[model samples]
Target: MDLEKRHEPPLRQTPEGCLAVAIRIPVRIVVLVLVVPVRMVWDALVVVGRFLRDTVFRPLGRALSWLARAVFVWPLVALWRYGVVPVGKALGWLGKVLLVIPLTWLYRQVLTPLGHALVSMLAWLYARVLTPVGRAVAWFLRGTGLVLAAIAGGVYAVVAWLARYLLVVPGRWVYEWILAPVGRLIAWCARGVLWVLEMLFDGIGTALYWIGRVLFVLPALALWRWVLVPVGRVLAVVGREVWDALGHAWRVAGRISLAVGRALATLFRWVFVEPVRWAYRTVLTPVGHVVRDVLVRPVAAVARSAGRAAREALAAARESVRQARADFRRMLLGEPRRVEALDRREPTGPETRTLGSSTTALTKD
Candidate 1:
């Protein structure tokens, strides 16, 4: 591919209307004039805010965090670690001693035996006395229940025969022979009435549905399709155009502001910075070099020479003091013993140890 084609932007080539072209130039020009100062002011504020955050706000926040830790967090931690923890442990020990130990002792030593004795007594009573009495009472109740059951069976048989003859047979005969025809006629009439009501309600429902369509649904649909749709489309077109204009103007204004800022920077550099830089480079640099070579070097050399002489004098004085100290020591303690250095090594190999000489045991002193 060609370089120009390869480097070309990948955006779609959508065409705008005549309205957009007419609006764009004026909008961008007006926006540039309006937005240049605002953009510069915004950039200045951003720089200032960053500076404050770096130099002032960040440190302030860190200091606040440290102060909070020292004032609130550290004291609370110390209280929990050193004060509350020990107090809680002491209270726990006291509870174990005064309450828990005594309770455990009572449960183990006194209450356990008492509970066992009560359980044993209850068991003995149940097994020895209450069991026999309950058996006797159960036998008596069983005998009485048999007698009552016989009496109840006799009464139930008589009542069953009477109910069959007097109530059940008569009710069955009346229901099958007399009432069945009337009930069937009534059911048929009810079915007809129900079918008629269903048909009537169905007609009413269809009518109501048509009425709702005419009164509510159709007009609303017409309003949406005819009036609202066209109005919304027009509004959407206007809004899209306005938004596009705003974006285009903003980009143009940014470029204009950037150009203005660069021009101002160049002007400032030429007016103020270049002269100062030239003076420093051409005039002040030479003067400073001359001063360093003439005045400063001579003064430094003299100071260094004086310092060297003082150091030599101090070194001589120190030597004299050392000799005097040595003489005083010799006069007080008398002659000192001399220590002769010796080399001691046991060689195990057939090699010369020092000065190419043998170190064998056969070669005695």
Candidate 2:
């Protein structure tokens, strides 16, 4: 009987049965979760109300009572202490003055400095912004003026063009008509002046011509008279001398004439040859000297200087070639040998690897 009962009771739960029980438990837990929040909020509201009544409302009620008494009595106390009693008023005044004076001084000093800095910043801003605005306004005004001037110029050009095209002929005609009589009068006056000047010039020329003829004739007559007188005296003297000399001593006379001819020739030679020699020496010789000294010598000096410059330039070229040759030899041969001697050293770390690699790859290329 016990064995049969145990076997019957051992009814094992199936997977579907267990799943159904698990689903029912979740439904109950969901119901409890929805209800618990509402319950918790209600409890919390009740607790808060109780706390407010105990801690805040009772204290506030007592404070109001006390504050009503103090408000009713405090003004009279303040009046007795500050207004009527006046106890240690001087000390209070000193304290107030000390506090107020320092506060006022601090306001004046620190606040004034800060205010000045703010004002300066504002002024700088004004300068940066407003000044340019003002200048822009002025520039706009100037542009407006330029536009007005251009407009005026255009108007003036149009007016002038119109005047020339429409009114110029009439204006010229009026001007000609108004000035014609005056121009004729001026021309007549100018002609009269020219006629008067011509007559005056003709009279002057006639006077000058007659005076010149008289002067020339008078001088010629005087010269002829004076020469003829001298000639007559000389001829009479010469005839007497010729008769006496020829009769007494014809041979002596011939000798005297020959002597006189030789003496005159000597005198002419002395006067003309000496003066010509002196003039040649003084004028031609000095001119030749000046040409040689001033013109020819300076030209020769310039030529010599040019020749010297050419020679110096050729020498300098030679010197430069020598220097270049010396430098080339030094650079190509001398410097290389010196560098090779200095470079005679053990291989550096990088150079050794390069040399080993070069040896290994010597035939690769």
Candidate 3:
């Protein structure tokens, strides 16, 4: 039996081994029952997720992106390219044709010619009327200035000559004729007075010396040496001691008071003044500056602009009124009437009498 068992094939190669495999078929059945449905459900879920991604989510995402681009970006691009750019170019072309070209032509044709005509008229007026008038006035003024200078020179010469004659001649005559005798007489009188004064002063000084030696000098020396010196020494010693003690106490008290005053001042400044100063500098000052700059300055500027505009309007109104008055007058009366009226108002020769007199004086000079 051992030989037959050893010579037999392995169980896997035998028919009974097939029966043992059949006996364990419940495990395979259980594995297939549990795992196959789970795998199929997992595969079905994956297929559904892929189908949803491709069919619903991806298309929806692409549609949303396309809708955003169409709604927001395409209109703006189309507007910039087709509407705004074309409109801007058309406006630029219209401006160049209507405003710039016409203005340039008007300036070159009408305004430039008008300006040149006005300049020529002004030049003619300046040359014909103003030039001669200015030259005549300048000549008159020059003659007047020359006459004034000549008169001033003559007056100065006369004054100088008179001064020399009056002062120098009189002074020389006085000195030679009257002052010499007077000065000699004064010298003689002064010498006599001085001699008398010298004699009197010498006698007086000798008497004063004797009187002071007896009455004042001896008493002053005795008083000072005997009484004043001892009293002064005692008083000086007592005063020095009192002054030293009082001065030392006062000095110490003054130092303490000064220290306390300084400390109090520092504390007061730190507590009160610094905060107020800081608040004023940081808040009130800036606010005041802002009010001045932002409110006051703009108001002043606006007022100035309004005043300038009003003045210009008033000037234009006045000019219009004057022109209207002139036109009304021209319409009411003939041109000859205005000319005759101007002629009647013109000055005759008598009106220039002062000027003629000045001219005559200038010619004479």
In model 1, residue pairs whose N, Cα or C atoms come closer than 3 Å (at least 3 residues apart or on different chains), thus clashing, are none
Residue ranges of candidate 2 with Cα displaced over 4 Å: 1-139, 150-171, 178-185, 215-217, 220-365
User: What is the clash tally of candidate 2?
Assistant: 0
Q: Please provide, for model 3 over 1-365, each residue's C-alpha lDDT reduced to its tens digit, 9 standing for 90 to 100.
A: 77666575656843444433443444444444455545555555776799899999999999999999999999999999999999999999999999999999999999999999999999999999999999999999998999899989999999999999989999999899998999999999999999999999999999999999999999999999999998997666555545554455455555555565578779999999999999999999999999999999999999999999999999999999999998998788856433434555444685544554543546643
How would the candidate models be sorted by TM-score, starting from the highest? 1, 3, 2
Show where candidate 1 strays beyond 4 Å.
Answer: 1-45, 173-219, 247-365
Clashing pairs in 3: none
Q: Model 1: C-alpha RMSD to truth?
A: 8.8
In order of appearance, the predictions have TM-scores of: 0.60, 0.21, 0.25
Q: Kindly list the per-residue Cα lDDT of model 1 for residues 1-365, writing each as its tens digit.
A: 57656575788988977766666667566656676677767766876899999999999999999999999999999999999999999999999999999999999999999999999999999999999999999999999999999999999999999999999999999999989999999999999999999999999999999999999999999999999998997676667766766676677666776787689889999999999999999999999999999999999999999999999999999999999999999999987988985665655456647665646677633
Highest TM-score, which number?
1
Question: How close to the true structure is residue 74 of candidate 3, measured as C-alpha lDDT?
Answer: 100
Model 3 RMSD vs true structure: 54.0
